[model samples]
Target: MIDPHHAPTGTAYATAPSIVQEICLIAEASGSGPSDVSGDREFRLRKAALLDCIAVQERARYGVAASADADDAAEVAAEWLVEYDVAHSGLSRKGRDLVLAEEYRDYVRAEYEAWSRSQAV
Candidate 1:
């Protein structure tokens, strides 16, 4: 229930392609030639997952009432994203990605809901 209006816009998240680009670079360096079909597919999937997580986090952080504690929400969301990145950094070819997992999204939603309730009280 994030307030779309309160969500930060035009920030680095909007223009930062470095995250996915770095992943692609790594794939290429790992002996999966630049044109490797599997590598390309993995890159696309990873990119989508990363963006989805960002969107989810942003909504969870900003969707709450404006009166809620913004600082606390922001901190929690930031921490979550960092941990998510670390967790997915070593994904194997056949390993399910965090972004594609319903459990991870649910976890974020649950955390946000808890934080929002705490702030409301």
Candidate 2:
């Protein structure tokens, strides 16, 4: 896990929106977005998924023990929030590895399980 950072109380976040915009800009330019972004449905889906992933990552950050490590293993829920040097929060990097790691254990397991089920046919 990256070293957990803590900012002072009542931190101003004038730059947070820009930071989040930067993350979104990267994903948009990175070709990581959905295949069909020309419509509302796909856009909504991605946005919702982003929010959901962030929620899960936030839960993991709060719920995971500070002492947790790869060796300190146990099953727990996860979220996909991407923390940056500003504002201390954002779901700006939707499908990144750090985002995935914050998902604790279930997200990847669920994905693999889904894949396994698909392969069973």
Candidate 3:
């Protein structure tokens, strides 16, 4: 139970990916065992943390896009990031309750690529 909110900002940002990986490990461990109350609770918490980490990564990347306004592409990318942040926030709190399925990831990736292409034009 790491409280991602209480973690130092730099440390939290740097370790987000690791946090997600840790959650995956927890999920794998629980998958191997029979269902238990405590395990279920742990899984839920880890999933929430994973979602928070993902949001943090997205925001960080968005910040980069916002700051790097060298041309129209960068500007469009920044706008896309803003829209993404708003839509994603509206969807779920740090995506905690939402399932992070492959389809969802693919959709986000597709949106990102489209944004990049828009910048190229």
Candidate 4:
């Protein structure tokens, strides 16, 4: 069992998609599967990440609907990421949790940034 929880700090940041994929794979291998079921928080975060990606792809295509969906998705993604970090880290305080989550958050931010930049070009 590769303990994802034991993954080093910043690794999550550098590998958002990989992390997401691993989670999905684990969820699947667990017999329940990601699509079969997940906790509220996990589902919400997954949806947010999905929507956020859709919005970015749409924006790259210059779609008018991208802005609104993207904003909403981004907001939700951040919210879920925070929740996820808190849940996973089990820190005694917000400060410590935030510190732990920062790398992952930055990774998400970078994904969006790269997507946005590509759209510009």
Candidate 5:
């Protein structure tokens, strides 16, 4: 099985693995962001990261975890990101209506796969 816990800390993914790790890293984000980000952006990212972690953790209480859980968590996190964009970037009405779940899911799946890939199983 792939172990996502020790995966590299990069999130730039071009594809996705069909299955996730035994544990989800998105649920474990420490929220201790990089020390370089010192501004409202950092706070906003932390808040969104909190949203992502909480939602994913909550999602785990249901039935067996599925790949879609990542999508669900990403969608929830995107809500906060959209709110920030609306307030700061002036997102269009169309933009406000959509949650960029795929992008965030890509991150989740990518992180999991990174650890999974490094494992022997």
Candidate 6:
């Protein structure tokens, strides 16, 4: 799991806005209730999913585990947010933007799980 507090030196990738944008788009399109992007579960799960998707889509996009990785992960997370169409999209009070971030976390988790499963085989 990528530490929210501690990012890689000289590679601290920050793109929370991208996820915010996706969340807004989703809410705009679906017209549903607020999204469930918050707390530990949401962040961890969605962040994982985002990472996995980025890796599958393209490793080079992340560069390392710093700038590129964070950026790609953010993009994937934002994508999920937009895709989910969670209402009240921009409801993150702490500026963390949990709503959009959660989806990406889920994506990254799924990616690792699949990879782990394959390795077990």
**Best model per TM-score:** 4
Off by over 4 Å in 1: 1-39, 64-121
Kindly report which residue stretches of model 2 are placed more than 4 angstroms away from their true locations once superposed: 1-39, 64-121
Local accuracy of candidate 4 as per-residue lDDT tens digits, 26-119: 4564466444433444454444444444444455556656466565655566556556646775633355344433343444454444543555
Model 5: lDDT of residue 75: 66
**Residue 62 of model 2, lDDT score:** 61
lDDT by residue (tens digit), candidate 2, 89-111: 33334443434443433343343
Task: Tell me which of candidates 1 and 3 scores higher on TM-score.
Answer: 3
What is residue 36's positional error in candidate 1, in angstroms?
7.9
Candidate 6: stretches off by over 4 Å? 1-31, 40-44, 60-121
Q: Report, for every candidate in turn, its global Cα lDDT versus the true structure.
A: 0.42, 0.34, 0.41, 0.47, 0.42, 0.43
Q: Using lDDT, give the best candidate's number.
A: 4
Q: Score every model by TM-score.
A: 0.26, 0.25, 0.33, 0.38, 0.33, 0.25
Off by over 4 Å in 5: 1-39, 42-65, 95-121
Candidate 1 to truth, TM: 0.26
lDDT of 4 at 117: 52
> Can you list the residue pairs that collide in candidate 5?
2-116
Give the C-alpha miss distance for residue 63 in model 4, angstroms. Answer: 5.6
Q: For model 1, how does the per-residue alpha-carbon lDDT over 11-90 read when each residue is reduced to its tens digit?
A: 22332245457456645655665565433333433333344445545456566454244334434444454355445665
RMSD of 2: 16.3
Error of 1 at 53 (Å): 0.4
Model 6 compared with the native: what TM-score? 0.25
lDDT score, candidate 4, position 73: 58
